[model samples]
Target: MPDSDKLAIAAHLHVLLRRKTGRVTDTEWMAVNADYAAEVVRFARQRAQEDGVPELADWADRLDHAMHAVAPPAARRPLLDVATQAVRQRAVPAAPEPVPEAPRYVGGIR
Candidate 1:
């Protein structure tokens, strides 16, 4: 599955876990979503190996969004934890960093 999708799934689970009970850190997130975490790790490895699949640099971000937990960009421990767990498992494809389409130059030329 796509790295973002994997992360989304994991994040979804994380949110559920948090809502169902109490607070959780990155470590706890890993413990809770072991399977999805493994998937994220696997995806990262594939990208590192220069595999055919698209590389997704912001898999963590996607997951964070899915989890509905918005923190500073610097604070990505939760995302990392999920990816690490996934990598420990089987291969998971990561969509490469999106080369954003050029923004529409709506402003008048200087």
Candidate 2:
């Protein structure tokens, strides 16, 4: 890919990562964004190789350096798991319907 294309891809990846995950806690950073961070570095490296942007390679190096600060991905509960647990903890049983009363008879009726 051309240098410009690679740079654009890298920027887009970073923007999307930031938007989807927001600012992650230090413990959750890699679990949420490692793949995205790696993708940005991959594209940045490609950008550096294309024609004239040596700075792109520098960017890729910096990105790699930053990646080390993030926590490594670890086993974490999915959102569904958390939601299901919450529902179970507070579940309320459905109320039963009452039976209808029988019709009353009139003494004057034949």
lDDT of 2 by residue, 1-110 (tens): 23344444445445533444342222234223557657656765675576355665675565566555533456456899899999997797768899798657667574
* Model 2 error, position 37 (Å): 1.1
Clashes of 2: 0
Residue 18 lDDT in candidate 1: 49
- After superposition on all C-alphas, the RMSD of every candidate to the true structure, in Å, is 23.8, 12.4
lDDT for each residue of candidate 1 in 1-110, tens digit (9 for 90 to 100): 33455445555444543443343435345434645555544544445355332223344344434444445777556878888898876576666897878756767654
After TM-score superposition, the amount by which residue 34's alpha carbon in candidate 1 deviates from its true location, in angstroms, is 5.6
RMSD of 1: 23.8
